[model samples]
Target: MNLYNLNPKYRILVTGGAGFIGSNLCESLLANGNTVVCLDNFATGKKSNVTPFLSNKKFTLIDGDIRNLSDCHKACEKVDYVLHQAALGSVPRSMNDPITSNDVNVTGFLNMLVAARDAKVKRFVYAASSSTYGDSKNMPKIEDVIGKPLSPYAITKYVNELYADVFSKTYGLETIGLRYFNVFGRRQDPAGAYAAVIPKFVMQLMNHESPHVNGDGSFSRDFTYIDNVIQMNIKSLVTNNTLAVNTVYNVAYGKRTSLNELLDLLKEYLTEFDLKIGSVKTTYGPIRKGDVPHSLASIEKAKELVGYNPEYNIREGLREAVQWYWNNLK
Candidate 1:
């Protein structure tokens, strides 16, 4: 699915454009012939991610922080749409420093919302999270139904939806929130303590080290691929459906994979490059706090509303990601 070909290109501002998912969005937009201005403070985003686009005539990188209103205003200048991806991610990180997480995720989000509203962008599409589903034990998580936030990071993301809702209602700004599941793919950072499961495991397995599974390895998640997420963002950006506007959709592959199953797939894919990766053992640990046992999204809302059809499932995405890491990061 070539999403860029489906809509008329416009000048877009991508906050956190130097991050994993943000860089991919910038690349896709630029490839489709849209002008892109990227704003980043490099707090969690890496400069290498945007270095490839520095030479593009249509690409501009603004060294700025989303927490500052002035920076948000500067980034939003003359932008047609805002794909707000800037936020402090990871539940463990949030648990460690709730104050900083709230400041960046909540306050920074409001800054972007106000700036986008003032700039009069066509629409504001921000990254929400599956963590917002919290303790809801529902197998196939839906949009409307939610539970109490399990961690500070989840609280911050949920607050973003509330603020976006109010901004749309009170200020007449067009907004869409995509509740992303456990998103993973190429360029996803695996070095940090908050590194995602896939990349972390891939790196560990690549080094012939034991990858640790939290708990009995039965805890599952709707591990979404970056390409599918990009599709959802583009769909949210271009969709003219009245009902879809000012709403949230689950951005996921609509399937769940257990931790043990995830390791098997990663090994299967990575072993093609180095046979030793297949023999790497895994260690099990107690499940961390604020961690849910299972998470799966009902992407029917996205399919019905934004025409989201994920082309890459777990196996397909993991194959590409493992290859990228092997070639680039190995």
Candidate 2:
């Protein structure tokens, strides 16, 4: 179902390789016998995430900030491919401090692009957010059609796609952007104020606390798993089709789950371990600013081009996520 036969053959650099998605990518790249150089400043990245890989002979960790062009250049040295995942992510966080968000997401992104171009890397695959589909009533969002951005974070991610396009056209650097929806899995930090909904809810429910739901728990998202994203990233790197090089792809499980349904599923899974979790309630609150009511993705582009067939649905991934939190945090 996946292009698992193709193994990476060159050195790769993963910026923000200590964060949730970044760390997972680093692990996969290294496991496939590629030399991995991980660049992370640990602003939001956890040291524990990368600690397990520290002893691997093929793995190297560079403690550097992507905001600094010199640091970016340093990380790009001798790297054949760049998986750019470094950025301050969270719509609400950007809403509170748009200036900082711009600096990290926009300026830092430009620095990585320039560094990748200067180093003559074969390809640059950067994480694009689904928030870019802002204010659009479109269901099953495709790659081509996008609406105006709703938040500073969305603006920064949309700008990333623009920069990638410009780099591909102007500098001839191969680039691909994966527009990820609500990605969730093990190792995604659930302790922060801006933690993602799934992980946040898992932790709250584990503690027997009523998880809060925004807007009557009607909002939904195309919750994708970590493995599906990793598959898409690997596919983006290994694909030989020239037309698929300089474009974007929607990364999701092709299904949406509402908040209320998600909580019910989580409780159902957790109750297998503890009977009391089944009685936990959910709190409703006003919808937060920069929030969208629903999100779904048309993954046909990815499937037709790169053969990206996601293996995990919300229930499958949520079961694993809840188990991890119970085993690790309980």
Top candidate on lDDT is 1
RMSD (CA, Å), each prediction: 1.1, 1.3
- Once superposed on the true structure, which residue ranges of model 1 sit more than 4 Å away at CA? 1-9
lDDT of 1 by residue, 118-161 (tens): 99999999999999999998879999999999999999999999
Model 1 local distance difference test score: 0.93
- Listed in order, each prediction's TM-score against the native is 0.98, 0.98
Report, for every candidate in turn, its global Cα lDDT versus the true structure: 0.93, 0.92
What lDDT is obtained when candidate 2 is compared to the true structure?
0.92
Q: List candidate 2 stretches off by more than 4 Å.
A: 1-3
